[model samples]
Target: MSKVEDFEELRPLLFSIAYRILGSVSEAEDAVQETWLRFDGSATRPTSTKAYLSAAVTRISIDVLRSARVRRESYVGPWFPEPLLADPYEDPARSAELADSLSMAALLLLERLSPLERAVFVLREVFDFGFDDVAVAVGRSEAACRQLLVRARRHMAAGRPRFEADRQERQRLATRFLDALRNGDVGSLQSLLAADVQLVGDGGGKSPQLAKAVSGAENVARLLGTVFPWLVRIGVTFEPQEVNGQPGAIFRHRDGKILQVLVLDVLDGRIQTIRGVINPEKLDHLGPVADAWAADREVKQARREWG
Candidate 1:
């Protein structure tokens, strides 16, 4: 195939690799585009187009991540990865690995690793790339890449819950939870939550975030139970959808603009965490973002008048 054909064929894989490393859909797309530019400008064809493009995108993502980390250091409030509606790449052989690594929890875990270690782990562990290819992707020796992988695995394992709910069970619980939330049924919502469950919001100081993470089943359930109904009354609605391979919802303004994306992390038959990403900058790729500040005002006014 020609250069364009090869790049297009591998685009999904390249975007997936970059997205895993950078946690920003926009940045990942840029890395993939840059990879194509380098490939197109090359004087000769590579022996393995997949390997060549993968290495280029990985290296670019790693560099981008390093700078991004610096910015994140001073970021206001909690940070969550831009919500990914769907992953373009699919390999049945590595389906389990792919699904597990795409969660918001997994991406946040990746944030704790050094950029090189993150790249090595994503290429080797998640994508099942060979050691030689992994080494080339991160510009490290095979031995060094293996060492990085070991560290990444150790860090990720330390952060993961001991027993996570399977996909079907998690979906079932999310459905019930969303139903309870819509009804403002705090009792039902609490029943689905783990005792230590936490509801975290990532408005990145650009919107109305929780003053802090609300923890405990009662507290979280009450907060969701109260706030969401008010949002509904003020013309906000949510549609259940999968986000980052987990059950989630995309909330929209009355006019149908994006408001936020909420994802649930279920473990051991209960909802362990509820993550809401409301930063407009992060939501832009999903579609037209709502004015969250204005939405907040509307909610407050509706509560006072409707009550």
Candidate 2:
């Protein structure tokens, strides 16, 4: 294949690496576009197109991440990676790993790692780039890259899931969990939430949301009873949909305005974290959800349709 064709074929991988490292869709897109510009204006064909493009994107992402971290530190309320629709990759295994890394919980954990470590981890773990390529991508020695990998792995492992839950079971639980909350069934919500469950909202101060993270199952449960009912009263409707590859609910105002997105992290068959992103800026990337989100469809039925 021609170099152009090769780069096109590998563009998805480049963007995935950049997005995992930066965790912002717009920055990732800009970095990819810049990478393409550099590739397109090259004076000579590189021996390996993948290596060249990957390095360019990773380095650009690292630059973007350095600034992103600072912005997030002062960000209002909670912060979340932009919710992505199913990523564009065609392979099943890669797509699955991408989903895991793109998850809000995983991204939050990643925030603790240094930018270099994040780049190394994304290239090596998420994209399965070889150490030699990772070294080139991050501008580190193979040995140094391995050390960064170890540190990144250790930091992320500290927050690893306690146990894997069945996907279908998790989805069923999410739907049921939302149902209980909507009906003001705090008792049922308490039963499904983990003891240390935490609920966080990212409203960016542009909308009304919890100012701080609320913890404890009882606290979150009581919170749902108070809040969900208010949303219902205000004509806000909820729909079950996949947010960042996890089962979550999106709230829309009666007029079809997107309100908030709730993404739950389940562990051992219970909800461990309730992540809500109401920041209109973050939801902009997910774009409009169509009129059906405002449709008065049953949550379970909607899950089947949107899932």
Consecutive 10-residue window with the lowest summed lDDT within model 1: 160-169
Query: How do the residues 10-101 of candidate 1 rate in per-residue lDDT, one tens digit apiece?
Result: 99999999999999999999999999999999999999999999999999998999999999999899999999989999999999888888
Q: After superposition, which runs of candidate 2 have C-alpha atoms over 4 Å from their true positions?
A: 1-4, 93-96, 288-307
User: Against the true structure, whose lDDT is highest?
Assistant: 1
Question: lDDT tens digits, residues 1-307, model 2?
Answer: 8767887899888777877888778888899999999998989999988889999999999999998888888988777887766665555767667778878778778889999999999888888889999999889999999999999999999986432447898899999998997898999999999999999887777666776899999999998986676557556788998777788988887777777788888878899888888777777777654333233343335446644
Clashes of each: 0, 0
